[model samples]
Target: MIIESTWHKSSYSRAETNCLEAAYMTTGGAVVRDTQNRSLGYLEFSAMEWSAFLVEVKSCDL
Candidate 1:
């Protein structure tokens, strides 16, 4: 897979655990990956999916 060139670390990620990083792609949507092992490939999510995920995250339902 061709990784996006402008990937950025998410501010929500914990400085201690180093879990997730996210970035917007030129084609649209976004990419999400584990900061500790980015080479494993990332999971792509559409804008709607990401928005729903954020809502769930804010709800603390995890």
Candidate 2:
């Protein structure tokens, strides 16, 4: 069964139209996408992968 995700934007995002959105998948993973293009779809990442990505982003290493 395909489950819907609850998408959310970053609290730190500027008061602009363009931003990023993310959602947790029912499959124990997460998905991210651009707020400006919902039709383009999203990128999926495993829980572990998402954690590592968050670490790098916090460190400004991306």
lDDT of 2 at 46: 85
Clashing residue pairs in all predictions, respectively, total 0, 0
Per lDDT, the best of the predicted structures is: 2
Task: Report clash pairs, candidate 1.
Answer: none
Error of 2 at 13 (Å): 2.7
Tens-digit lDDT track of model 2 for 1-62: 23366789977666576688888877766898888788999898987898899999999998
Q: Give the TM-score of candidate 2.
A: 0.71
RMSD per candidate (Å) reads 2.9, 2.4
Quantify all predictions' global Cα lDDT against the true fold: 0.79, 0.80
Worst ten in a row by lDDT for model 1:
1-10
User: Which prediction has the highest TM-score against the true structure?
Assistant: 2
lDDT of 1 by residue, 1-62 (tens): 34467777878788778778888765556789999898998899877887788789899986
